[model samples]
Target: MTQYTQKVNETTLKMPVALLQVGMFVCRLDRPWLGTPFLMQGFLIDNRETLQSVRALCSHVFVDPNKSLIQLRSPRERRRSRRETPEPPTLSPTVDRDMARLGLREVLPTYTRTLKGVKQALREVGRGHPLNPERLAGQVDECINALIDNIPAMTWLSRVKSHDDYTYEHAMHVSLLCMVFGIHCGWPRHEVRQAGLAGLLFDLGKLRIPKALLGKPTPLAETEWQLFREHPKWTRYLLEKSGFEQDVVMACYYHHERPDGRGYPVRKLGTQVPLAARLIHILDAFDAMISYRPYAQQRTVYEAIRVLYHGRNSQFDAALVDQFIELMGVYPMGTLVELSSGEVAVVIGQNHDARLLPKVAIIRDRNKNPVAEHVVNLKQLRDAEGKARFRVKSMLLDGSYGVYMQEYTRHLVLDASPA
Candidate 1:
């Protein structure tokens, strides 16, 4: 029999790769961490793909039992667990039935309407007209209400829609993400709406920047960069002059501020920054990275999430970054992914507690050809052999294998009407 090392007296235990589970915390790899694709030095095996990767990478690893979500068990129990196939976590019946009641089709109109409001607000700022607070408040209220009723539908719309005009589109995306995150944090409805408004108006200052500078594909000169940093101040000035609430104005002003004091326009660090400002900061950075910008190419959702994780406690608020990751989950809405069965699908709904088992809309078959759209709930799916039927193999970029979210909007019952 092969000798297996299990140091019960130490904080870290040596475990064979075959004994690893989804909730296990892998603290050290047998090989150099840099050689592998993991973003964090130590992380939990949150999903099947990560578990498989670790099995393929090393024969054994060091796991921190205290950091793991699962309990350390006897070798007999561990062997039994390895022999039984693990199933995705299941959601409560009431919650499952409630989620099924709402769909993207029911929420698309509200999303489109809120997007128009975002565009109109930018137009007001550009024309030097005062932003109509009443109009803005109405739109924000409607959007928040829609999100409160159905988070997945709103998130799907935000991820799928990308306008040629990046300004308002980016604003809309940030605002929706902020509201969703606020709800996840259990904030009151009024507070969630405030965060959404602040995010929607965070970048009005950029409208005051020069068009040449905004569109410049090359690096900005020092003088130009200095001028660009002044936009946050301009944003504050514009919002205050329009008689907006002080909280909204301040959030917009400090949205660029970083926890490490490296951010522009005042460099407020730590607890000195308001909670709303900190929340907007993470969402703003994330949407910008994933959006098509003048100087930067669009990144995949997973790529952007990795950047956020690496930047925690430095570029963004640490707790808020963790909360955002939990809110978005491993496969966020609208993520294009390839299944182990070779078909391609888009994540459409989250199973709440079961973050790894999101409901996906299958759009392409094994041959990578377009097919009639169908929804698959990964949590409940099982094959004739009673094993898990589908598992996500890997997440793909926006246009991988000719799968683009924009091209499938019609099938999603969105972008079919004039915006």
Candidate 2:
């Protein structure tokens, strides 16, 4: 695939024809000047008159370097020369009517409530009688479906009140992240739901540990470590007591197991670890790396992903690592990046074919001046030769830019406008 750079609003004009828009983001333009096509290295700063004139002459206006002004043939001519063509889908009134029958907004709150209930159930697990494992599973299934259906529309995390309930909240976040990976992998709906449930409950073992140990900022001593090793077994007992399916209980018990047999508990290796368990292990590690612990600051998503990628064969399953990389992109969600053009933006989504050139929304310039209200689709713009205009030179952590991602996430979801 073609590699492109990201640019901000800054544009550099190359004499008469070329315009180069460079910053944290970059775009190049080569268009005809006077009578011949010219190449520029910037955004269109003075094309209002030219754009209007070209629009009058053709249905679509494209820049040409060799010619000053060329009249292109109509769409009919292009259609006639096609080697192969797929027919456009026919839209019917019945299809539109059927779509109208679906109620989307009615489902969002229901799913959100279900997530809350799942968290409650997980929290209640070892406190008294065992919680309902089947109900928790059902809640997870609902949340996954809701998330998949809303992914395209969800530009940022929702503004729910911050809960001191760490275990349940963390479980929910991990499940959501795993679901994102699952969607990227094109997993079937059923499989994705199962993965989400596994992710949510992967840390059930932690609940069996003493509250003091769970909250400790210091490293565990030998005796404490010995107790830590048994948490998985305790977790399995808890699940079995709650009447969970064997597979679900195993998924929770073995989530920490590694492919290299280097992980905790049984130290099972490779195929001995179930697929659900393996995926949960990777997701669990990723969530831990990016999340703040009492002893350490959180790492950026990009940094955590890099650590995971580098440790693929040893620390994680190689194939699952590759799939996760593809799922999250080079700059995963919550990553702050500086573009080659010198503008800074947060990566909100992945561009699969262009890992290095995912879509970014510009927020700051080279001088760190705020330009908070802009959104740029880096994949849509091209150069004079119809080539991608910008490239991503490096990825930066949000902390380096004086941005706290969790705080930012809070503001993004709560504030009505982009800040």
Candidate 3:
């Protein structure tokens, strides 16, 4: 009898084309088999024609030893084989707190650029032209890169939104937050970009909604309400017609769906919902809550966050709700807060390591009078006695204590909104 290498349990081996034999059972082709004319689950290379067909399409193939009718290697070669060591995957740890904050600040100019481009794209699309997919893609790349570098500056800029620019800024804010949220969820770079693009376009259908309906102070009538409910499907159709990818299309379509199956259109429930859609839904609601819309009084950042927490299981995904709360924090940026020092300040940024002790810009003094506004990073402040100074007393609602928000944030680094 012909000598054969001792067989063990089923094992896969990468074999060169020259070594293939009639009894070898092919497992996988190096290239896509569907692209080739040959169609089979896998073939037993029992003849020269079969071997020739495979070699024509692939430089090498995977073979199963157990499936092969004949043994592949001699006993000496089998005994000599040793397992190859696979290199461990390289992991990158997120930057330290201070560095990350600095990184966020450094990307503001990039954000300004992307924001300008996005606003223009939206305008064109609202005018009935399809958004240039390439342009939107470039902005998404810039956004993802900025968020990956450091979250502070972008986080800070997101809060600098002006009520006057609410229409233009809402999309930009959602897009930025989506990238940040995606990174928090440990998504890969490309996936983060996908989230960003989806977010920027999630409200595209609303652009087509008559401004009169959107701006009505009273509740929307049933006809107007029906139009609002239909926006998600409209957005999905527009995106599909515009050649948007499946991820973006589905995210836009299902974003308004509720976790409790009460949401508009599809009414998808829980994990059945697309992750992108769920994330955009949470962020969309958050932005709308905090925005100074013509119809609704702007809710304080604290108040909006409270609402999100309250609706977690029914209106939003519970895990994502927790993650977002931790990400945005109870005292997130733009929150107008009073310090134990009797100072009134607007939250400017967060100290990642010390979330409760965020950086704030002192807009008013203990007497509630406007002062020479300056930033006080809570983590760095200390009393004359060398003890940490300044804890948040309570977050005041927007407009409760009035001051010019634009002027306070208008540092040398900030100028007019990008053209």
Point to the candidate with the largest lDDT: 1
Task: Spell out the clash pairs found in candidate 1.
Answer: none
- Given candidate 3, what's the lDDT at residue 61? 78
Score each candidate by Cα lDDT: 0.81, 0.60, 0.75
After superposition, the stretches of candidate 2 with alpha carbons farther than 4 Å from their true spots are 1-115, 152-166, 183-190, 381-390, 396-419
The TM-scores of all predictions, comma-separated, are 0.73, 0.67, 0.70
- Report lDDT (Cα) of residue 272, candidate 2: 89
Candidate 2 per-residue lDDT, tens place, 168-224, comes to 656766777667777777888777777777777677777778989877789889999
Model 1 scores worst on lDDT over the 10 consecutive residues at: 91-100
TM-score of candidate 1 to 2 decimals: 0.73
Candidate 1 has an lDDT of: 0.81
Q: Residues 1-419, candidate 3, lDDT per residue (tens digit)? A: 11132233347776756457788998777788777866886778898788777766766777887789997764456546633434332211122333434444478678878878878877888888887777888878977777777675677667765768786688888888989988888898888888899888888887778888878899988988998888887788778878988998898889988889999797778888899889999988888887778788787778888899899899888888889888887687667899998899877667654577887777789999888756677866655533458899988766657754444445424432333
Candidate 3 segments exceeding 4 Å error = 1-105, 374-389, 398-400, 412-419
State in Å the error of residue 281, model 1. Answer: 0.9
Give one digit per residue, the lDDT tens place, for model 1 in 1-419. Answer: 12344764568878867567899999998889897988899999999889888977887888888999989765566567767956444434334333433466678788788889888778878999988767887888898888888887788766764448678788888989888988888999888888888989998898999999998999999999999999999999898988988888898899889999999799899779989999999999898887777688878888999999999999999999998998888998788999888999888777654467778777799999988766777866755433457788888877778777766654445323335
Model 2: lDDT to the true structure = 0.60
Cα error of candidate 1 at position 85, Å: 25
> What lDDT score goes with residue 130 in model 1?
82
Against the correct fold, how does model 3 do in TM-score? 0.70
